[model samples]
Target: MDTPFEIFLSAPPGLEPLLLQEVTEAGFAAPEVAQGGVTIQGDWPDIWRANLTLRGASRVLVRFAQFRAFHLAQLDKRATKLDWGAVLPAGAECRVDVTCRNSKIYHDRAARARVAGAIESFGGKVSPEGSLRIMVRIEDDLVTFSMDTSGELLHRRGYKEATGKAPLRETLAALFLRQAGYAGDVPVVDPMCGSGTFVIEAARWAAGMAPGAERSFGFEALPSFDADAFAAMKAEAATRRDTDLRFYGSDRDDGAIRGAEANAARGHVADLCQFTRAAVSDLPRPEGRPGLVMVNPPYGARIGNRKLLFGLYGAFGAVLQERFHGWRLGMVTSDGGLAKATGLKLSAGPPVAFGGLTVKLYQAQL
Candidate 1:
C-alpha cells in the first residue's frame, strides 16, 4: 500500500466547516478543519478524486515535506537532499513561491532562489509562467513545502464563459447552498440571478454531477499520475440521476438572461434549469414545492447607490413575504445594513471573504 500524504483542501475563509462537512461526506479520511482549509491524509488517487469531486474547495495542495532550517546555508543544503523528483517530473517546468515570517530566512526572494536552485539541480526547469507551482512557507523557523495540485483555482469549472457584473464564484455558491441546508432534493430560485450561478449550481447538485467533470486538473501533470486509473475513476464518478424538480433564475437584464441560458446549456443542466428576463418585482413562484431562494444582489460598494439599493431590497422582501409561502431565503451582501433593509428577520452567518470584500449570508424562512 502506498503511504498516505497530507492533503490540504482550501476554501474561502470563514467557510472551513462547510468544506469539512463536504470532505467528510465524500469519504476522505478523517478531515480536520484548519485555520485556512481542511487537512486530510490520503494517497495520490485520493488527491485526484478530491480535485475531481470536491465542489467547495478553492484549491487542493499536497504537503510534500517539512524541515527546520536555522539559516540560508542550512536551507539550501536541506532543500537539495529532499526527493523532488518523486512528485515533479524531471523535465517539467515548475514555479516556486516562498513566504517567510518569524524565521532566519526573512528574505522571500532569497528563499525562493535557494529552493528554485535545488529544484533545478534535481533536473526540473524553473519558469515564472509555469503551470506547476511549488509553495514554501517559513514560519517560526519551521519550513513547510507544499505543491499546488490544482493549477487554476477549482472554481474555474470551464463552463461559465460569460458573466454579469460582480459575478459570484461557483465554489462560494456551492458553500452558500450548503449553508442554506440545500440537499439537492428541492427546488431553488434566484430572483436577481446574474449569470445563473446559484440556479445552475443547484441543478448540477440535484443531478449528482461532479463540478470538475468538464475540466482538467493539475494532478494530471504529476510524475506519478496514472491516466488509465484516472479514466476509470472518472467513469465511476459519472452521475445519471433523474430529477423531477427544476431550478429557476431571473434577471432584469436581457443579456444576463441569455448568458445564463448559455451557461446552463454548456454545463449540461439546461433541462434541469430555466432562466428568464424578469425583474425582482415581477418574479413569480415557479410551479413546485417551495424550496430555497438564494440571491447575490449587487453590493453598494461594488455597484449602484446604497440608498437606492435599500428600496430594491425592501421590495424584494415584500414580494417574497406576500407571495412565496413556505420558502427559505439566503442573500449574500457586504453590508448588513442593506440586508436588514429587506425587512425580513434574517439570521446572519459568519462573514466570508469574497473578491476583497467581506460578505455574509443572511438567511431566513419566509
Candidate 2:
C-alpha cells in the first residue's frame, strides 16, 4: 500500500487529452495521457482519490505489477509469487479478465485460468460473477496486472435513473462540457435536454459538488482500503460554494422534461436548474446575462427524417442566433450536414465514440 504504482484513469477514446487536462487540474501527480486513458504515479490513497474525484474518467485501474512470461507455466509461476493477500482481501471473490496481444501466451482463457488458479492458491476466490475485478494484459510476452477500482461505471452517479433514447453518458457529458469551455461560472441551457444530462452536469459543476460525492467505489472491497482515511479525504474535499448562476433546459417531449426534472432533483440541483417542456423554436433564454447554450439535438442516426432534422437544426440555430445574443453554443451530433444546417460557426472537436457511433463537439460564439 505504501509503494507507488501506476494509477490509470480510463477515458473515452478521442477524449483522452480532455481527460488528461481534467486530471491535471484535479492535482493528480504527474498525469500523463495514455492510449485510452490517463496514467498517474500513486499508491492506494491516490487510487482511492482518483476514483473519488475524476469526472472525465470512466474507471480507475491500479496497476500493481508487471512481469515477463514466455509461456503459460512461467506466467503461472510468476503469478503465484505475487503477494495478492497484501492487496486483495483474503477469500475475496474476484473475476479475472485477460487479454493477449502479440504474446507467446496468446490464449486469453488459458491465461485467465492460470491467473485464477494462482489467486485461488492464495486463498482468494475467482468466480465468474464477482464484485472485484482483476484485469490482465499480456502484450509481447509481458504481463501487466491491474484491478478495477471502480465497480459500476463512474457515469452512474447514483442518479439519473430515467433516460430518453440515446442519452449522453454523464462522464462524456462532463468532458464535453469541459471541452466547450464551461468553467462552472456561467449559466448553461440545453434545448433538447434528454434526461437533463448536460444541464444537470452543468448545475452540479456550478454548485461545486464532486462528481463522486454520492457514490461508493469498488476500492472499498480491497484489503488495503482504509475507511477512516477515505472518509476524511472525502470530508476535506467537500465543497458547496454558493453561486448566482442558474442552469436551464427545455424539451419538446413532455415525458423527457419530466424525466429531466426528476434527474435534477435526484442530483441535488433542482433549485438551481429549471426544466420545461418546449420545442426548439420555443426555447427561451433565461432572464440574465447571456451564457452558453449546450445541446445534443436529434441527429439523423438517432431519430427523425434527414429533411426534418435539417429543418429542426436550422430553426434551432435561428432561435439561438436571433434571441440569445452574446451567448456561446455547443452541440453534439454525428452528422455534419445537420450541424451545418444550424448555421452556427461551430468548429468541430475530435470525434468521440459514444453508444456505437462517433460524435463530435461543435462549438462557437453565438
Candidate 3:
C-alpha cells in the first residue's frame, strides 16, 4: 500500500470534469483526467477517501500494479509473481472482470480465462456473485489490476431499491448536479422525477454528507483492512452541518412515489425531500429560493406516445414560465425535439453517454 498508486473513477462521457472535481476535492493533489475516468497518485488512505466522498464517480479503483507484458507467457508469469494475497484474502470468493484495449491480449475472454486460472491456482477463489469485483484491463500490453473499492457501484448508495422502467443512476444524477452547479442552499425541484433520484442526491449533497456513509466496500475484508483507522475516519465524518433547504420531486405514477419514499428512508433524507404524485403541469411551485429546477422526463422509448410527449414538454415549458418564473431550469433528455418543445432558451453543454443511450442535460432560464 506504500507504493505509488493511481485511482480511477469512471464517469459518463462528458462528465469527466465533474469526476475530476470530485477527485481533487477528495484530497488528490494532482489529478490527471482521462476519458471516462480520472487518475490520481496516492496511497491506501487516498483510495479510501475516493470511495467515501466521490459522489459523481461510478466506482473507485486502486491501481495495484501496472506493467508491460507482450505475450501470454509473460502475462502468466507476471500474474503468478504478483502479490495477489496482499489485497485479496486467501480462499476468498473472487472473479476476474477484464477489458483489453489496443493490446496484444485482444482476445478478452481468453485473457480473462488465463488470469482467472492463474489467480485460482494461486489460492484465489472465484465467486461470480461475490461482493468484490477485481477489474483487469490490458492496454498496449500494460496489464493493470484494480479492485472495486465500491461494492455495488456508487449509484447503489443503499437507496433507490425500486426503479422505474428507465431509471437514472445516482452517480449520473450527482454528476448532472455538478454540471448544473447546484449549491444546495436553495430550493430545487424535479418534475417527472421517476424514483426521485435527482432530488434525493441533492438532499445528500446539501446536507454535506458522504455518499458512501451508509454502504460497505470490498476492501473491508482485505488483509490491510484497518478497522480502527476506518472507525476514526468515519467518526470524523459523522459531524454533520445543518442545511435548511427543501428538495422537491414529483411523478405521475404512484409506484415511483413509493420507491422514492423507500429510497429516501434508506438514504436518511426522507425528511429533507418532498415527494408527490403529480403531472408536470401540476408540479409544486415553491417560493423564496433561486435554486434550479432539474428534471429527467421520460423520452418516447420509455413512455408511450411521441406526440403526447411533445404536449407534455409544452406543458412543462408553460409551467416553468408561469409558475417557476426567474428560476433557472435544467432538463435531461435524449430527444432534441422534446427539448425544443420546452421553450426555455438553453445552451448545450455536453452529451452524457448513459447506459447505451446518449443523453444531453440542457440548462436555461425561465
TM-score of each: 0.98, 0.97, 0.93
lDDT against true structure, model 3: 0.81
Per-residue lDDT, model 2, residue 216, is 91
Question: Between the candidate structures 1 and 3, which one is better when assessed by lDDT?
Answer: 1
TM-score of 1: 0.98
Off by over 4 Å in 3: none
> Backbone clash tally for model 3?
0
In model 1, state the lDDT of residue 210: 86
Checking candidate 2 for backbone clashes, the offending pairs are none
RMSD of each: 1.3, 1.3, 2.0
The candidate with the higher lDDT, 2 or 3, is 2
For each candidate in the order shown, give its overall lDDT on alpha carbons. Answer: 0.91, 0.90, 0.81
Tens digits of lDDT, candidate 1, 199-315: 998998889888888888998999889999999888766564789989999999999999999999999999998998888999898876889999999888978889899999999
- TM-score quality measure for candidate 3: 0.93
* Each model's total of backbone clashes: 0, 0, 0
